[model samples]
Target chain A: MFCFIALLVFSVLGIFSATHRKFAKEAFDCVFRRITFRPCNTGFREKVRGIILVKLMKRSSFFAKVFNKYFELIAWIFFVLMIVSTFYVGRGAYNFYLYGNCNGVNEEGFCLFDPTGENNKISPVAPTCGLDTPTVDDLSLANTDLDKFFFIDNNSEDTVVFIGCYVCDFTRKAFPDIEKLLEKKKPNFYFGHLPVKHGSDFISSYDYCAREDTSGDYWKFVELMFTSDIENINDQNYLQEVVDKAGYDKSKIDECLADPETLASIEQNIFNIGNTNIYGTPLVFVNNKAIVGPKPYRVYKGFLK
Target chain B: MNIKKLRKDFYFLQKKNYIYFDNACNSLRPDCVVEKINEYYKEYPVCAGRSNYALAEKLTTDLLGVRKNIAKFISAKEDEIIFTKNTTESINLLANSLDLKEGDIVLTTDKEHNSNLIPWIKLKSKGVIHKTINSNPDNTFNIERLSKVLCPEVKLLALGMSSNLDGVSIPAKEIIDLAHKNGSLVLLDAAQSAISEKIDVKYLDVDFLAFSGHKILGPSGTGVLFGKKDLLEKLGSFLVGGSTVHSSSYDDFELADIPERFEAGLQNFSGILGLGEAIKYLEKIGLKNIQKQKLVLNEYLSNELLKIDKLHIIGPEEASRRSGIVSFYIDDIDSHQLSIMLDRSAGIMTRSGQHCVHSWFKSREVASSLRVSMSFYNTLDEVKKFVDELNNIIKILR
Candidate 1:
């Protein structure tokens, strides 16, 4: 009984080093008292011997004497089982803590995200163990044709959508440069925009680029838009100057711009880009895998594959 | 409910210096429980039910009385409850005994501790399909998602009554009612909930329940599994030998009635006896008072811990939603490494890791977290010291 209590104390408080060392000292003291009678009245071994004598005495005196001779060995077995079982239970608990399973086999594996079981059905790309999820869903504007908006080699077999705002200088320079380099290497390379901007200016810009530009000179039109004076972007007639310079029919461009569906499409594009879960501009994805913001040409070359 | 007074009963909590905040793992046992175990070994060391002696008869009667007390504690009949080694074994026994065949689905929450998750998951090899409904990001059970998965194919829904990761109680009664309407049985893993919250199995009409005694101030290697009486009769015994049967012939045998058929062989009689005393100790303190005191400590800890920078508390930020647990993570420091520092610096013992819910962590890509689980014996002073030490440790580690 005392051994059982000692095991319990050893299990609970022994997680701390100080308490563990104190228990070690107490255990040594207990063992010392069991072997030597110094500073002890009666030890656990003596009590077990007394109990064995009382039970054996009821049968025969000769058997009682014989059993009493090996009582210390019996006490050792009892104490060992108590200590071992306590540790066995502790080990089982530790296993349960680390692996959730008693055997510590984590074979059922982990669901990458959304243990709601909608992970696979939601997106095929969300389960990449070490990769960032390219989470463009059905609501994304990337599914729209680049030719319907601003075309930059829309006939290419491989396409990459670069989500950025023309107000940024990095997008003004990097978009065309990457498109030129990749287009020369593979004739079927396309760079498209799912445009984002800081304010309502994106609506007019997308309306001009998507609806007004019809001669396949949309790339030249966007280039003229980004390089022009920053304050003239919102002016309707000044925008017509940039649009006419890119060789668009001015009356046709105005008629195309009058449709509310053009502005609604741009608004939907901004909303779709916002829903992509990307925080920064100039974020590009080759197929569905995201490339970090505005990398060097050599780095983009590795990602183009 | 008075922490300072209740602290005196526990050998570990009586220490003025050490702070034990891992009660969700294993609670500190009271002196009465230890004394009861010692009394059992000293007075009647003989085995129960297999002997004709006076001590053996006394042992059998005392064991039965302990079962009766446990049944009363959980609002169950003595015949409906069966004792096992721990909650894991209890769940495993139910998983093995229940009549689940091929194409039969068992539903569980994604936030379940491994004890509840692994048992049902292991049944996939036996043609039982295991499906997990997504828990809310805060580790609370999402009833809407539970409703989505409670289809006709679902034979049983095993879930933790409260999350071990975050101490939020699941809406067990509502889930049971919904599952019953779907024609599915419900198994509540009350390992964390049974101690901190009230569990009236009868009122909830829970078909099955499993809980570990060690998590509720009782002895380790002690657990209880409760089932409806008719359901218990329908399920076969997972373990069969010795006391499981009342009579046997050469090739055939009749298993004993409800509870005895499940408790095979010689049981943990000493631990069960100690558990009976632990229940008595809890009842004396009033479980409602214990629950209320834990909430007070949790509210204090939550308010203070929220003030610290770089400390992110898991689960709902509101105190009303959480119970006696607060699992959080600090920036830059790994959870296991930080826990070692806490133990060495201030004698603060906390659990740090996935907390047996690796799937939950994996879903969020969160590797580990530091959990501080409280009990009724914890004090405001202790909580303050823990928070203060945590602030200091973050400073040094950062």
Candidate 2:
């Protein structure tokens, strides 16, 4: 009972000491000092100390749990954020849908009624095709958008070919010849050619494709014009290694690389035969649209109307 | 508790959608702000200066008015406030303006955001010595300990009004008064406190206060520096540009007067106009009322969160004295995973990791923490929902 009484007496005295500066300067200093400053760190002590220790200690489950705890906190925050954001977006969408999206385009073209907005009454974009496929009629239909490209075969009965620098070697060789033949067969053949290289003294054959975005890299195409090891360019394994390291998927694109003969023929046609708009070697163009040397003739040829 | 108003006010941010909780980082733009920007571009669109046209004059006047508004917000003379890009710029301006001798010491705390810490750290590296005081692991400010460290050499006592990490309020006024008694200058980083705290530079006798605009519902790329007129006049201007020159010759040039001298070049004009609007909006609501609502939310979150097992809140438990920030951690989750999961699954947003208060977190024996900060715009349903999500996350995340 005396001990309890003594404790109460000390507590009162302690409170007094804490309040009065003259009586308890040192005590105040101690509390004040305690309120400020974290203790010093050793050389090994870090702000994010023990973060890697879990991995170093091979405590996978422990690390996962620890990691998850922080993420869980983030999750709650995200949930709140998403709830707000979705509402915001949906409201905006709803307002636009109901009030009519007048931010330049008519309401009929937007995906307001269609999935991914693909079935709108407005212009449709041509579907991206594999390297060898030539479908000009599909590419330039009223169903597809042509304004964004350099060339359009809209309402034309011809096929469209997309020209790429890296496809098949055989197709590259035979493309130029086919392009000239196609142009002869149909004087009004329409095609699209991408100047992957901005400018490197090429002869112009005819009308070029309409442009969307302006060229930002003038030196990029010409930079690859002369190659020290052309074989390495076609090596799928070497390319795959690069793509893999860069985190790109190569497994899904086996067919594009498998047809080397087609690639070679296309290469030969472009560099050797049809309207040689490019200097004295591998050149390819469908009537008016063309690029010089080893370009994807199949794509360009497919675009003839 | 008022979901109706919150949902309407923040109608721009409703859910299954990503709600960004990182207001301290950058608040999501309100539609009022977005439309203001659009109106500026589509309607009264004109460059501020460099033209004698009516739009130009209006833009110029609007720009200068924002500087005046910033001064009133922090309780300073119009000429004392200089528009800056953000808090880092304001602190940098102060750091550069000061004369740092080889032996002079700058006193600061471990709770400093790197914006406040690095300028002095760099000064220390350049021969000016620095002394650091610390908060207890929980991050509270104590004045007596600071007085002990204020030797004759200590020239500046740099501090934050409220810590960015845990939102623990520092006794900024008391600390400033104490530092002045020691014949040291005090600089308050009001980045975390400005929106919530009612600052009276005259009552507190603080020499300088700095804050970012975005944290207060204003636009980014804009900030305010509030310095006493006398000190601003006494200090050297760090940025010298076309706008800051009073007169110039081939070899010699006269500098512009105080605030103009400090505000060197082209400013964020539209941002300033937006900041003025935000200030007016806050004024109509009143800081005290906002503080009250934020306090209730902070208390609700802290008390409810503490009941969960294995949870460690990083700072003070009381709601009245602290800023509306709660940083806590569960036993074993890597913070980034939770941040990502929070984004993908829960649709919530919170700041994770050390929050740039590296020294404080280290001293407190914390690896990393998750911070949930509240603004007046936030609703209690969001808080309850946050706590509920947190509970489920802690369960499965473990």
Residue-wise C-alpha lDDT for candidate 1, range B284-337, written one tens digit per residue: 988788778788888999999899777789899986677889998866656765
Error of 1 at B224 (Å): 0.3
lDDT score, candidate 2: 0.61
What proportion of the real contacts between chains A and B does each prediction keep? 0.00, 0.12
lDDT of 2 by residue, B51-87 (tens): 7999889888877787777677777788888888989
Candidate 1 CAPRI grade: incorrect
Model 1, range A163-222, lDDT digits (tens) per residue?
Answer: 555555556545664665555645333333444444545435444454455653666766
DockQ, computed on Cα atoms, for candidate 1:
0.00
* Location of the lowest summed lDDT over 10 successive residues in candidate 2 chain A: A201-210
Question: Can you list each candidate's DockQ?
Answer: 0.00, 0.06
TM-score of each: 0.57, 0.57
